[model samples]
Target: MRQSYQDWKGQSIEAKRSQLRGETKDLPVPVHIQKEPPFWDVFPENPEVFKLVVQARALGVLRLEENRNTEEKVIRYTRETVIGSENVEIASSWEEAVQVLEVLACRPDKEAIGRQVSAKLADADQAQDKLGLYDQFINYLKQREAELEKIGGSDSPDYKREATIIKDLITSENLQLDNKSKLSVIQLVISPEKPLVDFIEEPHISNISPVEPPFMAGANVFCTECGEQNPARSKFCYNCGTRLVKPN
Candidate 1:
């Protein structure tokens, strides 16, 4: 039997609460809507929806329309479907959505979700709220750092990407992040030594000649006055300083 909207919402709330209580794994969206076209039609008009669409397309679960070529077109179509609006003026919103989409598209892992949450937390205006979120952010960094270390360490693309996000967060002047949080974030990304993979054997150049031959044809100029055999490239004789005749 199909449950009414209220019943579904109630179940959603229960699931959320269970997730928070560690009784169930937290999912960003309802299980029914995750892979269903009917729910996709009514998906929320947000970055998460865009991420889902991109992920679906990447995984061959979704296909672009016949004429949709550019990213702006994709962005427009996403808005038109998710928000039920076709009048959106694509400007800074497109840029912001694109940034979020790129991050989410590159990573199909929970780390991408964590980055989104971190960005939102960094945007908090109230100092108290920021202070409260700082511990969570630190925990995220620690977990991400450990994961990266296990897989590919500091040289991993994932590590570099997360480090870039951390660097941006710390350097953003508008963010109200505390000094301690900033320092702690910095400590996670930087390292004193380069990765071993970066070291390469230098090629042997010790026996290579530094000087070139007189010419490609081994030609030389015999000075008329001094009989000095100067290189064909020389304009003047090396011994007598006399102008060499053209060798035709």
Candidate 2:
């Protein structure tokens, strides 16, 4: 047989060198491979053996050896058709893929802090409804300039043109106000012995009408013993003390 297949391949290469010296006899001492040089004395711009072969192919420890002249069933059918088999073997080295993309870009998220606290509570409720409509238009222009200084003759030019039209309707930055100056101050305070013109001409016709007697301008009255509306110059019931009565 060819010298008995050359002594069975020299006893299968001394039984794989005594089973690789008994599996490297408790490990440590193996480092000697060095001398490879001569590809014109090596260093072809040495990037440290291409960064240690890209850190041993990213730590999966760069394996590949089995070719026993190829065909151990075509190298175990090309290592069982090799395709990424569930990936995750990491370490290939751009600084550990930039430290795993900086730990997934450091967290933050609650929908961007709830859209910045809903845009600062809608800019503090539009600055508190524009400071409550500028204090109800400056207390209706200081009660129409104290009822045009109590009816005009404050050295009249119709009291300096209705106090410069109630100081340009309360310092106008245009918050509006002229419904013909509140209907010419409600037709200069109506009169048929004004209990606001008998509560606007008998509001619910005559509940014994006529007791709100004092200088009546725009009366209001109500109190059938305490419903309390009061204000035709109010002699009481400033919200329930009760006793005011004069329109009869």
Give one digit per residue, the lDDT tens place, for model 1 in 166-204: 545434523445444444444455353311111122235
Compared with the true structure, model 2 gives a TM-score of 0.16
lDDT of 2 by residue, 1-248 (tens): 43343344334333433454454323223222553212212112233333332222222233223434322211010111155432121122323321221222211211222233334324433333333444553554454456567564455454454345434433543333233333334445544332332222333543323344353455677666767566666665544345678586
TM-score of each: 0.25, 0.16
Where model 2 places Cα greater than 4 Å from the true spot, the runs are: 1-108, 118-122, 127-226, 229-231, 234-246
Clashes of 1: 0
Per-residue lDDT value at 204 in model 2: 52
Q: Which pairs of residues have clashing backbones in candidate 1?
A: none
The Cα local distance difference test for each model comes to: 0.43, 0.36
TM-score for model 1? 0.25
